[model samples]
Target: MTHDEIWRALDALAAENGLSASGLARKAGLDATAFNPSKRIGADGRARWPSTESLAKVLTATSTGMADFAALVTGMAAALPRGSRGPAARRIPLIGLAQAGGEGYFDDGGYPVGGSWDEISVPEVGDPNAYALEISGESMEPVFRDGDIVIVSPGAPIRRGDRVVVRTEKGEVMAKELKRQSARRIDLRSLNPAHPDYAFDLTEITWMHRIVWGSQ
Candidate 1:
């Protein structure tokens, strides 16, 4: 399997079990930091993969079959049994990226609130608090163009290299790739190289949500 797909499958497994990556590692009798984003890369900047033994332990701990795990890796876990069809589409809140920076769109915990939001039908996401944001500028172009709709999941685990939407306490919102996150700071990489990368203190961020899907 591809490196990204394997890691994503592991994350999906953890989420499906109502556990964080560290929690899944702990449940499998591995070190609590084994699945942390920091552990996914090495000191020399190379990818670090989870050992087969660790994967086996996780499967045993969760009682998940290899076939099911493979499905997750292939992003077909949402399909019906016997490969019939995917989950039905459902309505979720939709808002512009610019408007998301304004008040009345979200609760303190970052969940979409208020009743004035427009709605769009998308394939079902596990997170009930998921919502969509329509892109507006060229700052994130080449990857996310203007008018692109991205699905954001507040409940999803954030990992290194994942694209995310971040909102600052001062009411600024932007989408970038998560380079790294430490206790005190977060590093972000812009999708468009012309745009400057960003680094912010953890305190400056009001919320950061993973972008689970995007309409290119």
Candidate 2:
């Protein structure tokens, strides 16, 4: 088989086993970088092959046989289990980060309630009332980048040290890491390195919601 095809089969097998390629290698008692892309090509520019011992260990670790590997190679294997699927078919409102700071996008309870939102479908959702906001700029980089979607659970508890979405009575919305909270004030660390840590009076914050998931 061609190198690309073999690598694709290996990736598929890793997902079927619910582990990443590096994770699979580690589970098989090999170096974590064994299946990494950097090692997929040789210094002489020839296609690299997985060592036979590595293959044997991987198969034994996963309780998989050579026939299963062959099935993957030939595209004859059963689909990965639905529970391990990435996203479900349920839909939720998707709002842009820029517009999220505007008025009328949220209700008093801090849940998405207005009609200005677009929509997106996820593979599954634990919170039926959750909504999504797409990051718009490089401001939240390192932790979240442009176009990344964060699923906000308005009903979820907001605790100290959790990443959160906070709205204010003045029509401002912010996503940041919660540093502390008290009856009188809220302190936060910005995800964007360019931004400074912030402190706000509890009276100024209209609502707060903890982010439960994200599509990276």
Q: In terms of lDDT, which candidate is strongest?
A: 1
lDDT score for residue 44 of model 1:
100
- Tens digits of per-residue lDDT, candidate 1, 124-170, equal 56678889999998989899999999888887667788789999999
- Model 2 gets an lDDT of 0.78
- Model 2 TM-score? 0.60
Task: Provide TM-scores for the models.
Answer: 0.70, 0.60
Residue 158 displacement in candidate 1 (angstroms):
0.7
Give one digit per residue, the lDDT tens place, for model 2 in 57-84: 9989988778667645533333222233
Kindly report which residue pairs in candidate 2 clash with one another.
Answer: 87-123, 88-122, 88-123, 88-124
Weakest lDDT window of 10 consecutive positions for candidate 2: 75-84
Displacement of the residue 99 alpha carbon in candidate 2, Å: 0.1
Most accurate candidate by TM-score: 1
